[model samples]
Target: MRLDKFLKVSRLIKRRTLAKEVSDAGRVTINGRVAKPSSEVKVGDILEIGFGAKMLRAEILELKETVKAEEAKNLYRIVE
Candidate 1:
């Protein structure tokens, strides 16, 4: 799945457009390297997102086109 879509589908950023904007601004990384909005995301990939002064990191556990709000949390696992 595309990084932006994955972010939204997983409820990480809440919206696909916002995720794309954030990714385009270089505030997101995959496997430690900066990634673009269209970047591909796969299972097991590490994602680090910068949110103001805070940061969120997670590992992709699964990729789905759509997921229930209650099940979105199952798509990725938080990482330190």
Candidate 2:
């Protein structure tokens, strides 16, 4: 799955466009390296996102084209 798509489908960013903008601005990383909006994402990959002074890290557990709001959390697990 695409990084931006995963972000939205997983309800991490709420929207795909925002995810793209965030990613394009170098506010997102995969495995510690900066990532792009079109970056390919796979299961077990570590995703880190910067929201101003806040940082979010999540480990991808599953990939899906669409998921319900209640099930979004199952796609990734938050990491400290």
Give me the runs in candidate 1 sitting further than 4 Å from their true place: none
**TM-score per model over all chains:** 0.98, 0.98
lDDT scores of the candidates, listed in order:
0.97, 0.96
> Model 1 scores what on Cα lDDT?
0.97
What is the C-alpha lDDT profile of model 2 across 41-75, one tens digit per residue? 99999999999999999999999999999999999
RMSD of each: 0.5, 0.5
Give me the runs in candidate 2 sitting further than 4 Å from their true place. Answer: none
Measured with C-alpha atoms, the lDDT of residue 13 in candidate 1 is: 96
Per-residue lDDT tens digits for candidate 1, residues 1-80, read: 89999999999999999999999999999999999999999999999999999999999999999999999999999998
